[model samples]
Structures are given as C-alpha cells and as structure tokens.
Target: MTTVIEVQNLTKRYKDKRALDNVSLSLEEGAIYGLLGRNGAGKTTLMSILTAQNFASSGEVRVFGEQPYENARVLDRVCFVRESQKYPDDAYPRHAFKAASLFFRNWDQGLADQLIEQFQLPMKQTIKKLSRGQLSAVGVIIGLASRADLTFFDEPYLGLDAVARQIFYDRLLEDYAEHPRTIILSSHLIDEVANLIEKVIVIDNGRILLDDDTDAVRDRAVTVVGDAEKVDAWASGREVLHRESLGRVASITVLGGVSADERAEITASGLDLAPVSLQQLIVRLTQKAESATKVIAVKEGVR
Candidate 1:
C-alpha cells in the first residue's frame, strides 16, 4: 500500500500539558483507520494538525509527501468533518454543500444529493437553527460526497440517534467499497466503529499506546467466562484487560489470543472463551494510567 501520511517524532504541548509526546505513525492509502483514545488523548490534536487546521508544537507531519498546511495540492485532496463544524449564522445546509463542491475537485454532487435525501436533511433551514443531529447529517454528507483522497472525521456523529448512526455507517461502508480512500475516524464510540475500521490507533495521555491492524489488536486479548476461581486462575500472570464478577461467575479478558491448544486447556478448565470488545480494551489501556494517578493522589493525601 502507498504511504499517504508519515508522522515522525510528533510532539505537542499546551503550557504544562503535553498534548502529544514523541508520537510517530504512518497512514496507508485506501484503508480505513480508527484514531481512538480518551477525550483528551490528543486524537483531535493529531487530526487538526494533519488536516492543516492546527499547528503542532513540535514534530513533522507529511501528507502526500508534502506538508499539508496551505499546500493547495495536498490540502485540496483532504476533507475534514469535525463533530461540531461551524458555518455562518445565516448559511443554510444548501450553502454549505455548495461551498464544499467548489473546494473538492473530486466532489460528486450526485452523491451529495443522495446523502442529503438519505439523511433527510432540511436544506432550506439555516445551519444554526437545525438540531444537533441535523447538523451532523450535513457534515456526514459533505465528508462522504467530497470523495477526498484522505478524509478525517473527528466524532462526526454527535447527537445522532442509533438509527441515524446506523444509516451513516451503512452508507459509509457502501460508498467506501465503491470508492476506496484513506479515512481516519476519531470517535469515542469505539465499539460501534470497530467492525468498520481496517486498523486501530490508540492514544492515551498524549502518547500513542497502541497501533495495529484491528484484527491483530483484537488478537492481543480474549474474553473468558466461567467459575470465578477458574477464571481468576486462568487470568493469573496474564494481562487482564477487564474483569467482572457476577455471583459465583466471572468474566475476565486477558491480553493475547488463544491457540487451539490453549483453547482446549481453557475448555478443560471449564472456562468459555468469548470475543473481546475493542472499546473495552482501549478503555482499560487508556484509563489505567489515570486510575494510577488517582491512586497516587489518594496515598499522598493519606500520608
């Protein structure tokens, strides 16, 4: 696959806080990538920098073999759909679509029109007067219709109901199959987008904690259910991502895939193996650090 983006030693800081620390990653063309992390884990910062909407405190960001900022050639090939995209107070949905069509060379008016209908958008209504969900629909339509070589959607489903979100996902997959492009989706709803992404990139506390193909990342963990004691015994010495106890039964997720032999062993131990949710894994990895900090604070207070 061709490399569309190459980031090296990327670091960003805001006063005393580090937004991104020594981060380096590459994006493969014609693939869907998931940029995941906690709310303040630099997902937005990284996307903004990559899209040329924000500057990095330190680091090199290359898109299409050139810096993206004001590089017309590269910037034109990119479309960024933010969760809360801002438009003029008097601008209506139709006006936004018109602007996008002019900016993106590959923009498809037909697709935009279809998506508008699919989302049931009210084009005549001013953007500021639309519901949050309707506003999201406008951005989704632009992102899909622009057909940019590289599209960045930073949590573009805000305020969308389950039905609307499902429609968005279905349309995204359908259009993507016909028109393959590099897509970077930054969303907090990891599980919802888990099946759609080809790869996963996770950040925590301004640092990339995990980067791998979605399957490979899933393989790093497995869920087990059975007697609490048996589950605990099996999880012992293995990285337990998440664990829950219900009465005498317990479900424990461990870090690593189980080979046939391991599976047999687990079965023999009277434990059942289940698929681990990507969201669960990411939440555990990103939140553990914060939990530790809280623990330290508690200990300090006690002292």
Candidate 2:
C-alpha cells in the first residue's frame, strides 16, 4: 500500500515549551489509525498540523507526496472533522452541509441527508441551539458525506450518547466497507474505537510512545491471576505492566506474548491467564503524575 501521509522530525513549540517533540510517523493508505494520547499530550497539535490548519515550527509534512499547505490538489482530498469546528453563530445544520458540498470533491449529498435523518438532527435549528450530541451529529454527517481520500475525525463523538455514538461508528464502518479510505481518528474514547482502528499511534508527553498494528499491540501483553506470592514470583524480571491485588489473590500484567512453553509453565503452576483490555494497556503505558514543580510552587504560594 502507498504511504498517504508522512512526517519527519516534526516539532512544534509554543514559547519555551515544545508541544510536539521531534515526532516522525508514516500512514498507509486505506487504513484506520487511532491517534491517542493524554490531554495536553499534543494529539490536537499534531492533527492540526497534518490538516494544515496550523503551522509546524520545524518539520516535514507530506500528503500525497507533496506539501499540503495552500495546495488544493492535496487539500481537496482531505477532510478534518474536529470537536471545536467553528460555525457562524446563526448557522443551521443545512448551512454546514452546503459549505461542505462546496469544499469536498467527493461530497455526497444523499449520504449527508440519510445521516441527518438517522441521527434525527434538526435541519432548521441554529447550530448553537442543538445539544452537544446534535452538534456532533452535524460533524459526523459532514465527515461521512465528504468521503475524502483521507479523513481526520478528532473526537467527533464527544457529548454523543452511547446509542448515538454507536450509530456513528456503525455507519462509518458500513460506509467505509463500500468506499475504503484512510481514516485517522483522534479520541479519548479508545475502547469504543478499538475494534475499528487497524493501526494504533499512541502519543505521550509530545512524543510517539507506541505505533503498531492493533493485533500486535494486543499481543504485547497478557495478565495472570492467582496467589499473590506465586504471581509476583512468576512476574518478577518480566516486563510487568500493571498489577492489582485483593486479599491473597493478585493479578499481574506483563509485556510480550506468552510463548507456548511459558503458557504451559503458567498452567502447570495453576495460575490463570487472562486477556488484557486495550484501554488498560494504554492507560498503563501513558501514566503520568502531576508535575512536581507545580505542587511545590502551590505549597510555597499557600505558605
């Protein structure tokens, strides 16, 4: 497959702090990628740069083998649906679709109309009057209808109820099956999109922490449960990820897929092996404590 997007040593800085720290990544065509990170971890910054909505401090960004900025050829094939997408205060749902038709080359009015009805979106109501869920429906409609070669959906499900969110994903998957394209989804709701994303890109502290296929990531770790002492002993020296204990029982997660011999050994020891959830793995990998300097300063100021 062709590489649809490429970034090399991309860095973005604001004042004295770096928002993106020399990050580099490549995206393959016709794949769904999950762009995930903690808040303030630069996920938005990275997406903004990729979509040419914001300038990069220093780096290389290439879409379709050419620079994307001000290049209609490259820009026309991309659509970015973000949570903070601004609209005129008096703009209604229909107005947004009208504008989308003007921008996206592959815009499908029929699909947009279908989505509007499916979500029960208010066509005449001003965007500001709609609930957060309705606002999300507006974006979701445009994102799917645009059907651009590359679509970036940045937290497009926020404020959407579980049922509404499911509708969005189900429609996305169904549409994508018939019309395959490269999709980049940046969301805090990982588990919901876990099954949808073919590739995963995890960012932490302005850097790419993990980039791997979904199955490979899942295989990277497994959890074992049994007696605390036995579990700890078996987990010792292994790449232990996260652990939990209750009474005399303990659960320990460790990195890397278990080998056949190892699994036999675990079973022989009478311990149970359980599959680890993707959300749990990501949380453990991206864990961070509050800044110490801020804590110290707050104490000093209070004193």
Candidate 3:
C-alpha cells in the first residue's frame, strides 16, 4: 500500500481554541476511512487543512508526499465535498458538474448522470433555490463522480432521508469496489457507515483518540448484563466505559477483549455478554475522555 497522506505533529489553532492538537497519522492509497468524532472535535478542521482549504498553525502535512497548500498538482487529485460547500447563486447542477469535469482528471459523467436522476435533482433550478436535500444530493454526486484519488465526504447525508442516505451509501460502496481509492468519510451517523469503512479514526478534544482497523475497534470492548451485584463484581477491577441499572438488572460495558475461557466463565456466572456497536463504543469513549479532562482540570485548579 502506498502512503498517500502523512501528518506529523499537526496543530491548528483559532483564537484561544485549539482545533487540532499535535495530531499525527498516515493514510494509505486504497482504503475507506471513517473519521468519527463529536461536533467541534476537529474533524472538519483537519480535513480543511489536508485539502488546502485551511492552514495548519504548526507541524507538517503531506498529501501525495508533497505540501498541499497552493500546490495545484496535489489539489487536482483531491475532492472535498463538505456540508457547507459553496457555489455561485446562479450556478445550476449542470454548471457544477461541468466545472468538476474540468478539474478532476477521472471525472465520470455517466456516474454523475445516474446519480442526478436517482436523486431526482432539478437540473434547471439555481443552486440556491434547491432544497437542503437536493443540495446534499449535488455534493454526493460530485464526490462520487469526481473519482479523485483522495475524496473527503464531510457529512454528505446532511438533509437526505433514510432511503436517500441508503442510496448514497450503496452507490459509494459499489463504486469503491470497482475503483479502489482512498476515501475519508466524516459523518455523525456512525452505525450507518460502520460496515462501509475499513479503518476508523476517532478524534476528541482535538486529539486522536483511536486510529485502528474497524474489526479491531469492534473487539475493543464488550458489555455484560446480569444481576446488579454480579455485574458490579465482574466489573470491579476492569475499565468500565458505561453502566446502566434497572431494578435488579444491570448492564456494564468494559474495555478489553474477552477470550474463549473468559466468555465461558462469564456465561457460567449467569451473565449474558453483548457485543458493543461502534456507535456505542465511540460515545462511551468520548464521554470517558471528557470526564478525565474534568478531573484533571479540577486537580490543576486545586494547585
């Protein structure tokens, strides 16, 4: 696999807030990545810097083994379709496609036409007059059809309904299977794209929390359900990400993989084990990080 993107100690600051803090990661040429994080967790900021739409405050970033800022060679191979993508008020969908055709060397008009028709986008209407869902369809179409070596889809399902979103996901996976390229998907709908992405990069508080294969991430944690007393006893010395209790029943999610023996022991102890979904794991991880930060802040304040 070829390294297409490399970042070393990348940091971005705005005013007093640090959007990206010493982030370092590398991406290979042919894999779909899910850039998962909460709102304001630096997902957009990082993407902006990678695509040359924004500058990093400090540290180095290399796309295609070269700087992306003001570098047309690197920029031409990258497609960034963000929720807040802007266009001329008078520009129609066709104009956007025409411009994209000129920019992306691998632009596929056939795919773009299929998407537009499936999305039922109004070609004659000005971009500004299109509804939110229609506007999102335009971005989705462009992102999928551009066939850029590296494409970023930042919340591309903005106003799309469940069915429409499914279409986007289906087409994305189908296209990716045929055309192997690096794709970075930034979305809040984790479970929806969990199966699509090969790798997962989780960002929280401007820091890289988890960057690993999707299958490995799935095995990071497991949940146990049983009587409150038994559940607590089992989770006593373990890292518990989350816990819920209802009457005499309790459910506890803990960090660490369960071995075959451990699974047998858990079941024999009258506890049922449940698999944690990617969305659930991420939510717990972010909450845990936030709590730790609060504790650290309190400790500093005491000093």
Candidate 4:
C-alpha cells in the first residue's frame, strides 16, 4: 500500500486555542477512513489543513508526497467537500458540476447526471435557494462523481433524511468498490459510517485518541452485564470506560481485549459479555479522555 498523506507534528492554533495539538498521522491509498470526533474536536481543522484550505501554524503536511499548499499537482488530485460549501450566488447545481468536471480530470459526467436525477436536485434553482438537503446532495454528488485520487467529506449528510443518507452511503460503497481511492470522511454519526470505513481515527480535544483498523478498535473494549455485585467484583481494578446500573443489574465496559480463558471465566460466573459497537466505544473513549484531561488540569493547578 502506498502512503498517500503524511503529517508530522502538525499544529494549528487560533489565538490562544490550539485546534490541533502536535497531531501526526499517515493515511494509506485506496482506503476509507472515518475521522471521528465530537464538535470542536479539531476534525474540521485537521481536514482543512490537509486540503490546504487552511494554513497550519507549525509542522509539516504532505499529500501525494508533495506539499499541498498552492501545488497544482497535489490540489488537482484532491477534492474536499465541506459541510457548508460556498458557490456563486447565481450558480445552479449544474454549474457546480460543470466547474467540478473542468477541474477534476477523472470527473465522470455520467455519474454526476445520474446522481442529479436520483437526488432530484433542481437545476434551475440557484444554489442558495435549494433546501439544505438538496444543497448537501450537490456536495455529495461532486464528491463521489469527481473521482479524485483523494477526497474529504466533512459531514456530507447534514439535513439529509434517513433514506437519503442511506442512499448516499450505498452509492459511496458501490463507487468505492469499483474505483478504490483514498477517502477521509469526517462525520458525527459514527455508527452510520462504521461499516463503510476500513480504518478509524479518533480525535479528542485536539489530540489523537485512537488510530487503528476498525476490527482492532472493536476489540479494544468489552462490556460485562450481570448482577451489580458480581460485575463489580469481576471488574475491580480493571480500566472501566463506562458503567451503567439498573436495580440489581450493572453493565460495565472495560478497556482491553478478553482472552478465551477470561471469556470462559466470565460465562462461568453468570456474567454475559456484550460486544461494544463502534459508536459506543468512541463515545466512551472520548468521555474518558475528557475526564482524564480535567483531572490532569486540576493536578497541574495544585502544583
């Protein structure tokens, strides 16, 4: 596999707030990456920097083994679909597609036309007059039909209903299968894209929390559910990511993989182990990271 994008000690600061703090990661070609994070977690900042839409305060970034800033070679191969993309006031959906076709060498007009018809996007309406969902559809069409070597979709499903979102997901997977390329998707709906992405990159408070294959990430935590007392005893001294209790029953999610022997022990003890979904795991991990950050801040203040 070829390394398509590389970042080393990348930092983006706005005044006193650091949007990205010493973030370093690499993305391989022909893989879909889910960039997961909460609001204000710097997911957008990181993507903007990678696409060269925003400048980094310090450190290095390379796309296609070349700097992306003002480099036509890198820019031509990249496509970024922002959450709120701007277009000319008088331009319509067709005009947007036309511009994209001109810019991207691999642009497939057939696919674009098909998407437009499927999305029912009115070609006569000015971009600003279209509904939010329709506007989002335009971006999705461009992102998919452009067929750029590298593409970034930042919350591409906004304002889209469940059915429309599913359509977008299905089309994305279908297109990706036919044409494999590097794609970075930043979305708040974690479970929705869980099956679509090959890898997961989690960011929390401007820092990288987890970066690994989706399968490996799913194994990073396990939940135990049973009697409160029994579960507590079994989970004692373990790294608990989350815990919920109801009456005499308690469910505890703990970090780390369970061995076969451990699974047997858990079963013998009458405790049932449950698999944590990608969304659940990410939520727990980010919450835990937030709590740890608060603790460290308090400790430093005491010092």
**What's the CA error at residue 20 for candidate 3, in Å?**
0.8
- lDDT minimum window of 10 residues, candidate 2: 285-294
True lDDT of residue 296, candidate 1: 96
**Candidate 1: residue 157 Cα off by (Å):** 0.8
Which scores better on TM-score, 1 or 4?
4
Error of 3 at 258 (Å): 0.4
- Residue-level error in angstroms, candidate 1, position 169: 0.9
Residue pair clashes in candidate 4: none
Candidate 3's residue-wise lDDT over 92-158, tens digit each? 9999999999999999999999999899999989999999999999999999999999999999999
Q: Per-residue alpha-carbon lDDT of model 1 for 117-203, expressed as tens digits?
A: 888998878999999999999999999999999999989899889989999999899999999999999988998999999999998
Clash numbers, per candidate: 1, 0, 0, 0
* lDDT head-to-head 2 vs 3, winner: 3
User: How close is every model to the real structure, measured as TM-score?
Assistant: 0.93, 0.94, 0.99, 0.98
Question: Runs in model 2 with CA error above 4 Å?
Answer: 288-303
* Candidate 1 ranges beyond 4 A from true positions: 292-303
Q: Considering every candidate listed, which one attains the maximal lDDT?
A: 3
Backbone steric clashes in candidate 2, count: 0
What is the overall TM-score of model 3 with all chains considered together? 0.99
Estimate candidate 2's alpha-carbon lDDT, on a 0 to 1 scale: 0.91
Worst 10 contiguous positions by lDDT, candidate 1: 284-293
Which regions of candidate 4 fall more than 4 Å away from where they truly are? none
Which of the two candidates, 1 or 2, achieves a greater TM-score against the reference? 2
